[model samples]
Target: MTDLPSRVSINEEGPREGFQIEPGPIPTADKVALVDALSATGLRHIQVASFVSPKLVPGWADAEAVVAGFAPREGVAYTALWFNGAGLDRALAFRDRLSVTGSISLSASEAFSRRNLNRDREGNLAAMRKQTAAHLAAGVPVRRLGIMAAFGCNFSGEVTPAQVFTAIEDGLSIAAEAGVALTRLSLADTMGWANPVAVERLVGAVRARWPALELTLHLHDTRGMAVANALAALRMGVASFDATVGGLGGCPFAAHKGAPGNIASEELAMLCEEMGIETGIDLDALIEAGHRAERIVGHPLPSALLRGGSLRAMRARMAA
Candidate 1:
């Protein structure tokens, strides 16, 4: 067994990434109910929704209502994704309810950025900086920022680590200029392109550069390397992870061409517990949520939770 860290923080992305790729719209009341259930499970952070234009992502059209309906829990942190200044503006209205506000999209690879954000990597970075600046000027407490597809782009093939580092540097510089202290920043392998070696090396390099920044991991399971890659990150002391219930995820545009969803929250949670890392989440509750999500999508989710039972059950079955 690996010598796991004592604490692991799991950020539930079911409401945001989980619902992003479904064929039709999910009712706002359902979304609220899901968030409420997640809060009851004692998750510290739950992604409620994004504030993108309704034309782009119709699923998150009721972002404001979702936030308004949220009843503040003593320990849970509510978060929302934003695209640009306008999204931040929407998030600002619910300042009291929001614990963390973040902005993210594909990096400026012409092909990926064009389809995802309609901008190049540099242009999107500028927009992110501007929006972050505006939020800072308004005295908004923006905590975490995520850079999507930081490792490799589905449309661009392979992205250089230098490009990823440059983007982070740009964001950090912008944060300094805007005077917003970014609590955490993540490098997301949106298409599941990173291998263990690559994750290790890249994490090493990033840590050497910015040791103080909280590093978050957002890896996909497309190539079946999600667990292995996560192990690499954990070995390097990456404690925070982004996961969806039942491994449900898809970029609204990318799914049409076949981009798989994210790693399963239950799988990761089970792994963490087995490794002696505390995620503060009940594995049974998480698996039950995954099952519920599969039913809602009317399809089998890619999560191992749906295919395999708990680790102990699997072991017992083998013995039987």
Candidate 2:
């Protein structure tokens, strides 16, 4: 394995991304407690919840409540996902304390876009453009504008790199014209179809276009390539990544069964630590958190750390 930059940023999406996929509804109180515990782990940036329609995602019904209940910790920034103007307005109501922001996703393929966003790619972008203007006028920050399904799609197969670039330009163009400071922009592998080579190429292409914009990688372990793809992204200086605690998330439309949420946070932290990268996270604490999350979800997590020890132990000593 190759070494990484000394300092790195890890975004905890356990509360928002993890429970959002579980079969049973996670209680709002438990969600608040989990976010509180995560804050103590020294991870300042935590995606607490999503402000989506309760009917569609019942698990996130208590988003506003959880945001209100979780007290702010020093050095911690809490985030909520807002779909559009109404969602952004709901998030802004709590903007005084929690860091309320959102992600706008546009699939590379039209069919996938309709399946994921209930609209075509251009329609999604057009709606987000109007919302972007509103957010800017209200002085609310749009933490991350994500281009979802950038890598590939479950229904449409491999998404072209050109299409991904177009979405990035579209998102940036609106953010610029609206005078909105983008906290981050991420490429989400909503379908878990990205390989290491694809990740490297896509990330490199994005860096070439918007080198100054902070980039994040959100991957799924559908084909068991999340870790490898993430490592490749790290090699490209893509530091920030979105990972759940126990590998607990699946796209509502990205196929059924356990696809595993981005690489588990514990596993990512372990890899980063061994590679001399500082994630500012407590490895043991993160593992414990993963265990707690596994219990809440009532399923065995798809985490390498939970299954085995450090990678060094997996390899035998070289013959002398």
Candidate 3:
């Protein structure tokens, strides 16, 4: 077994993935405010927005404005998701003004590929290769290739390890053919269908296959096992994770309506601190960000840390 990483990194996706599914339109200014608040929490990486269709995902219609609004910090890395050529074009336009990295995302499940992206598995793969090449050619610093529905798909059910493996291999092969090296890969449990066993098995398999690749798990709390699955992956030496503040994210095309969202960033930070893992996040500040997110979303969020205080805070109160 490889040695476990002493410090785990978290990518904050609350502004992009978390807000994409909101029913009501969040003002562009509010979105920027939320991201700025999160930036103050010492989060090094944040997915600020996606360059998708505004008509389709009205919540993120202000992707460009949001990017323009946020103050770029020297240490923090900001990224935007791009699915196709047009999204890539949009991201490239702001490349000079904003220090933005690009993420090329694709799905592993055939049904999900068709449902979410209106393409089959092969078509999605082709698009991914093309988009990746474009980003590479543009000198956009394509940092991550995100594989959604890696564990299990809501439409197809039980996505096999072989399917996930093939997707990763194909992505790598495509990048290698273009002479571009991919450093990070993200496995997303799009519908929260993964358990601890599945997390361990798949994470271990990927680690074995690509020993040098950095792996990040994007898990949902649909079955309340997101944290448990994270623990399992950590045991397998996978250290990075994608988390949303206030746990406010769900796929619009997912089979389950009102499904639970990504693991809350504050909750995950609290868990890591308790486990002696260094996340480099201020838990109190993260909780405050969650509260701000709740106000922006105009609803009670699904974060444990937001609902109940952190363990440290509780212990201090008890001791006093």
Candidate 4:
């Protein structure tokens, strides 16, 4: 067995990323219930919603309402995603009232940057810089800077490692210039194009380059490699990951519409538990939450843990 971290951290993004791509709008009350459920499951971080244009994502238009609905737990940290100054403004307005952290996401691939945010690479970087500074100024802790499409892009096909490096450098430079310390840095495989080999290679390079920064992987299971890629990352010392409940989330702007969403949080946690790596998550409660997510989304989710019972339960059943 490869040496692993004593305790792994998982950030549940189901309330935001997972629900963002759903065709039907999830009611604010239901979204709040799902988030509240996740928060109670010993998850330290939960991304509640994104502050984006209602025109672009009608589902999250009730971002404020969702924030208002969920009861805040003392130990759990709530987060909101913002891509630009406008989104930052929305988050800032609620900063005092809500217990929320902030995330600033920028795409590495110029093609995706343009398609997703109507900006080129440089433009997106500039926006990220501005948003990061603004978020800090507003007293919202910008915990993470998400580099989207770091592994590869749907539009551009293969993204070079150097490009990903440059983007991270630029983002770090901006953060330094603004005199803000980032708590985490995330590399997102937005298109699910990363393989296990690629994951090790990229994660190794980044760890070598920036040893101090906390690293997280945001993976998509479009090609059924999300878990494999995650395992590869874990071997390379990436202890933090972003996963959605019931495997619900996908980028609507990506080239492939049928691509799967983020890896299921329950499934990942179960894998960690079975491997003897601690995640501090209640497996049964998490599976129950996954079932709740399925009810809210009104569809069958893609969670192996939800479909196949936990390891112990399955073993007990077989023995019986």
Candidate 5:
């Protein structure tokens, strides 16, 4: 309540997150359309595609095609996710279209590293070191540090603040070795095991250790706690977040099938607007994009705002 940020950044991850796990082969055009629609809704950042192995994530086999198709909005920054050098190369081809910066992505839970990334903690660190070098060699800056499974993991159980600290320390070491000064740090609740208190403790501890790193939260709604966890972080002055439009994504590798994905972008924006925190978003337009996402996927998404509608709009109607 006391330390809310004046402006919140909502990075929409629906196109990449949702498209990855859906059972059907969503058309490439539909994927591009969603990115374009989100861009028009005043979202400054949009994750358009994942450049991972098509064999591993067939949904993005047409990643190149989707990147080629979308109309890049001048003001919106489009980003893509790629785990290794090959994926990074694919993204480099669209460097003109996508924001091609890199991140030091690691997992707090060793078990989750093995499950999600198919590597142990040591292997993940080695990979990050190699990946960081690759990004620099390619002339792409590596500044953001991301820790996955920061709260708890379904495979390994409760994750304490200590485990998160170790992960962050490891990431910082990688960046330092590369001579890169990281400006941002992202703590992700990859498995949806985060609660509000855990968010506070972890965020507080991380900030205490590295006060210069700007913090971001990448939360999932696995247990319906993404919004609450986000609120907890916001109250502590953490502003940036990664969310999927209409709750459209789930981790295919986390073994949490049929689980809800990241927090809904429209819902998060509404919450921020209601709290007098500026999100720089058109909530109604974003809600309509959520509906469009449902139509593209041919199924209902988990966003309650998509169904219930925005109260702000209803108030205007009542006043009329």
Candidate 6:
């Protein structure tokens, strides 16, 4: 608890994560609205869309449109997800509006990679090597390493810290070979298999290995422990996280049938603010954004805070 960071950085993933998993098509305008609402909430980072093939992810076929649609808010860094050179090219078109940096992303679970990307661990590495080179060729600085399924995997079961370390090492090797120095690493609990103890152990282990690297957690709340796990990481001084508004995302390919999505952005924001950690986020505004997300998706989201609401307004009323 004493090691809690003075400020926490939350990367909003609602627009991309929520829409992409839904069965129905969401209007581009609604997606843009969520982005616009979230931006005004003092959130500094948002993952706006994924630039994959329409055949693969039809939800993001309108990625370019969404990118073109949003009114850019100053001081907020916008990001998008892409897997190959084509996706990279599409993202490059919006270089002026988006923070188009590259990441050397790997998966700790071999089974997850095979199913998720149709590539085995060795094959995935080879692809990453090519992707890293491509990114550098495009002048996109490849400075971040992301390890997906770092906590555990449904297909593989129980991803140990050693597997995660190996994934990080592979990513680092790719970066080094490309002459790209990585300053940040994001550990993803892609399927919501992380626990509080596991978060602490892995964070401590990673810090021991790469003490200088900034860490970010991408946690899923499928098993209902996302906030506790976040608190554990906070105690270990991890200040950056990837969250979705109203808990509006689930892994479509991770066999997460009816499971909850990523940790709710508003919940994480409320947690940090309640703990006296500055998140630079307007919790009420964020909650509004969550509500907007629910309206767009046309369903109740997984966020309890959204249903219960924050206590800030209640406190204000009591004071009055």
Q: What TM-scores do the predictions have?
A: 0.88, 0.90, 0.93, 0.92, 0.97, 0.98
TM-score winner, 2 or 6: 6
**Model 6, 12-42: lDDT tens per residue?**
9988898898986889998998899999999
Q: Write the per-residue lDDT of candidate 4 for residues 1-320, one digit (tens) a residue.
A: 46577689998999898678888778888999998899888898899998889998898899989887888888787878766678777777777545556566767788888877689877876777777767777776766678999988878878877888888877777777877777788999988889989988888888788888889999888777888888888888789999998888765544566556899998889878887889989877888899999899888887777888788667778999
Error of 1 at 316 (Å): 11
The candidate with the higher lDDT, 4 or 6, is 6
* Candidate lDDT (C-alpha), each: 0.76, 0.78, 0.83, 0.82, 0.92, 0.93
Model 6 TM: 0.98
Which is the better candidate, 3 or 4, if ranked by lDDT?
A: 3
Taking the tens digit of each residue's C-alpha lDDT, what string does model 1 give over 18-106?
Answer: 66668657777777877787777667888888888988778778888888886778888888877667877888788789865554333
Between candidates 1 and 6, the lDDT winner: 6
lDDT of 6: 0.93
Ten contiguous residues with the weakest lDDT in model 6: 250-259
Superior candidate under lDDT, 1 versus 5: 5
Q: For model 4, what is the alpha-carbon lDDT of residue 43?
A: 91
User: Model 5 misses residue 106 by how many Å?
Assistant: 0.6
Best of the two (1, 5) by TM-score: 5
| TM-score for predicted model 2 compared with the true structure | 0.90
Top lDDT prediction, candidate number: 6
| Model 5, span 1-320: residue lDDT tens | 77999999999999999999898699888998898899999999999999999998999999999999999988899999998889999999998999999999988999988887789988998999999999999999998999998999889899999999999999999999999999999999988889999999999999999999999999998778889999999999999999999999865534556667999999899999999999999999999999999999998998888999998899889999
Q: TM-score for model 3?
A: 0.93
In candidate 4, what residue range of length 10 has the lowest lDDT sum?
250-259
